[model samples]
Target chain A: MVRKRQILVIGNNTNGCTPKHEKIAYDIGSEIAKSDSVLISGGLGGVMEASSHGAHDANGFTVGIIPQDDASFANEFCDVVIPTGMGLTRDYLNALSADGVIIVGGGSGTLSEACASYMHKKPMVAIKNLGSSVDPYIDGYIDHRKNIKIIGVDTAQEAVKKILELITA
Target chain B: MVRKRQILVIGNNTNGCTPKHEKIAYDIGSEIAKSDSVLISGGLGGVMEASSHGAHDANGFTVGIIPQDDASFANEFCDVVIPTGMGLTRDYLNALSADGVIIVGGGSGTLSEACASYMHKKPMVAIKNLGSSVDPYIDGYIDHRKNIKIIGVDTAQEAVKKILELITA
Candidate 1:
């Protein structure tokens, strides 16, 4: 059986994010589904829920790695929820399990997962100039190692396409 | 039933560490086991293996969360092995699951886990003057957030005792 590619999307939670982030994440999630890849996220409210909602609506597989131990805490959109009971550390797992990552708009938590992706040599891309916390790291490396550049784009379609290309390349 | 305390040890792998680090980690592991707490680690090599070996020799429970998907990749010292198949991202899980953390000699991977622990508000302590990558954050906040401080200790016994106290307090 051919393994379906797994794509992870990281971003800000409800309070720290704007509505635009939600729309972008939703589109990215949908595009990932349309591209025949599984969608995964932190499984919480905000960008995570929005993306998962999009994927679930598009009839795509969705997985959520929640910080809480109770799977019920995951957004309703998650088809397969794994309650890690480990809190934010679970965020790193989302990055680790994915073939590539998309950063819509995020703060420290998303940056932490991004660091994990960089350390693991995973492909990643971000939506440009949304004034997101991840802006500094966009179009550049996360640190001095210069492991991989986080490609930047204008739309969710480009975001998903870029990640897939980077991964396949 | 009272839950047994879970302690996490993060540090350099075999290649980046010195023999002294191994000895220090082993002692820390033994001390934790003697304190009747479970020992947990990355389950790969160097500090992780030594700590698990110490705990196992002391007939204590040891859990190894391996970065690879193969359970066999874990050190034989591990009583329970979980292969995350998520690469370095699995390192964050070690901090999330533990009530407290101990830092020996470590690299960027360890620092990454340290960031997770801080975000989750997990208490941490490190060996002083070990020249590990985590030194900067020792006794200080990992970031401007300053959620928690990584205290400094001189010995394994002090490390174990301090963590138990911090958790109970």
Candidate 2:
């Protein structure tokens, strides 16, 4: 039997996120997990930790792909810890390994991963007003937005709705 | 005449070095600026802010490729702020545009950028004991290290020395 691929949450560690983003990510993550979608993240702090926590609380499997060798650094919520001795490339692998990518609040690092996702033709979802540098793809530019699927939602429920629709559809 | 390229420091958002990393990144940034190297960062707080402050104090150009559109989110030291509107992907460009990459105290985000530099085949320098990762690469996993050249040094002087040596040699 073929194992189902997981959903990669390409989150940002920028200034950390507000309570709103945390709530949104948590809600969406929980919903996604209830649907039996496996969650993966950078396994540190910020959205990765938040999403993992949400998934874990929902009794779903979570994977934290850490750049360091020590599993001690893995997110407290991760059930499976894959320690990559390769440093930051672990994030790249996280993006590449995902069947689809969802970007929560982010900074330059989030944008880089999005670019990689775009370059690799991966489906992407952006939580609106999350304050990402790539906000323009959804907000400002319409033509460029069509090149890649940029799904924007106001609520976490809607966010998960769109994500599930895109993935399962 | 070809314009000289700048040195971009891309690494973890967390100050893995704590109070010491702030001072170290500041010192190295100042030195690099004095030697006419422009400093670039992910444009968030912590090391990004510290190094930008150092370059600014030296009256050198400091560029912050921020993930957000608002220039106010950037540190006060930034002279050139590229509002990437791309989030973490902006950090990837910051690494791509650099002649070389310097890693200070970093976490997963920093590791991601370092890996990008490696994939892009850029020369890199790491502040010894500053990174939780890179130990394996420096020890003997030259094959795992790939096309990028990795050098480890204790002092800012040594980092500069090794970078110059790699460049000149």
Candidate 3:
């Protein structure tokens, strides 16, 4: 039996996220559900919550890697909760669990996830103008040789499409 | 038997680290060894390497929480290697294992560690002028109530002293 694709969605946990960022995250979650892909996130508020809500609304399986040992940190939409008790370090677990990573607006936490994804050699797609603080570091590719590239997209649909292609290819 | 204090040293893991950062990390490691405290780090290069070397030179017990599954990712000075295979996510393990955290110059990775330490409610002491990228976020205390504070010191000696006070208190 073929395994379902797991995509990790990374973003900020604060209320500072704009309406557009939340909408994009929600759309990405819906697309992932429609495609029968498993959605994974940090399981906190803001973008993570929005995406999980979308996935749950679409009847998609959602996993949240929570930093605390309690399930209370998880959003309302999470189907499965993995309490890591690793604090923000749980970001690594979220990235490593996914076949591909989709980043929305984020801060240092999201940037750490991006770095971890790059180090783990996971394909990543970043939605443009998402208020991601790691923009300077994500210079298309991670290295001078330009072998590893963080694919950029303009919209949620494009980001999901790119993630599908990367996962399949 | 009383448990030996565990001191986590966080810093830049790249060649871009300045000479002064290296010296402070080395000093912090030496102090940790002299105090019979176990030293821990990410077990990579730059400041991590320097601090590990200092601890090893002092014959201190040093542990490296490696992000990769391979033991080779650990620095030469690491006496004990915990290969987590979790990539940068292993930073949480490093922070959680320590009685206190001493931060040297760092970037996003170190900033993630700082955030984790705050969330875990661990006492942290940062060496001043360490080129820490999380300066803006480190508003002394992490929360609105200003209960948790990250003590800032101007020198390695001061950092060690502060760490000892925090851990023992």
Ordered by lDDT, highest first, the candidates read 1, 3, 2
> What tens digits encode model 1's per-residue C-alpha lDDT throughout A4-109?
9999999877756678989989998899889989998999989999999889888888999998999999999999999998777677678778899999877657
Clashes of each: 2, 24, 1
Per-residue C-alpha lDDT of model 3 across residues A88-138, encoded as one tens digit per residue: 767888878989999997865677677677767788999886657556555
Docking band of candidate 3: incorrect
- Model number with the top DockQ: 3
Please state what fraction of the native interface contacts candidate 3 reproduces: 0.12
Task: Name model 3 segments beyond 4 Å from true.
Answer: A13-21, A34-36, A43-45, A59-61, A66-89, A106-109, A125-155, A161-169, B13-21, B34-36, B43-45, B56-61, B67-88, B106-111, B125-155, B161-169
In candidate 3, position B121 carries an lDDT of 75
TM-score for each predicted model, relative to the true structure: 0.64, 0.53, 0.71
Instruction: Sort every candidate by TM-score, greatest first.
Output: 3, 1, 2
Candidate 1 residue runs with Cα over 4 Å from true position: A1-6, A18-39, A50-93, A105-112, A115-120, A126-161, B1-4, B30-38, B52-93, B105-120, B127-147, B152-158
lDDT of 3 by residue, B1-169 (tens): 8889999999888755778888888998998999999999999988999999889898898999998999998889999999998767687788789899998877656866776777677888887755575554443654333435788788888888899999889
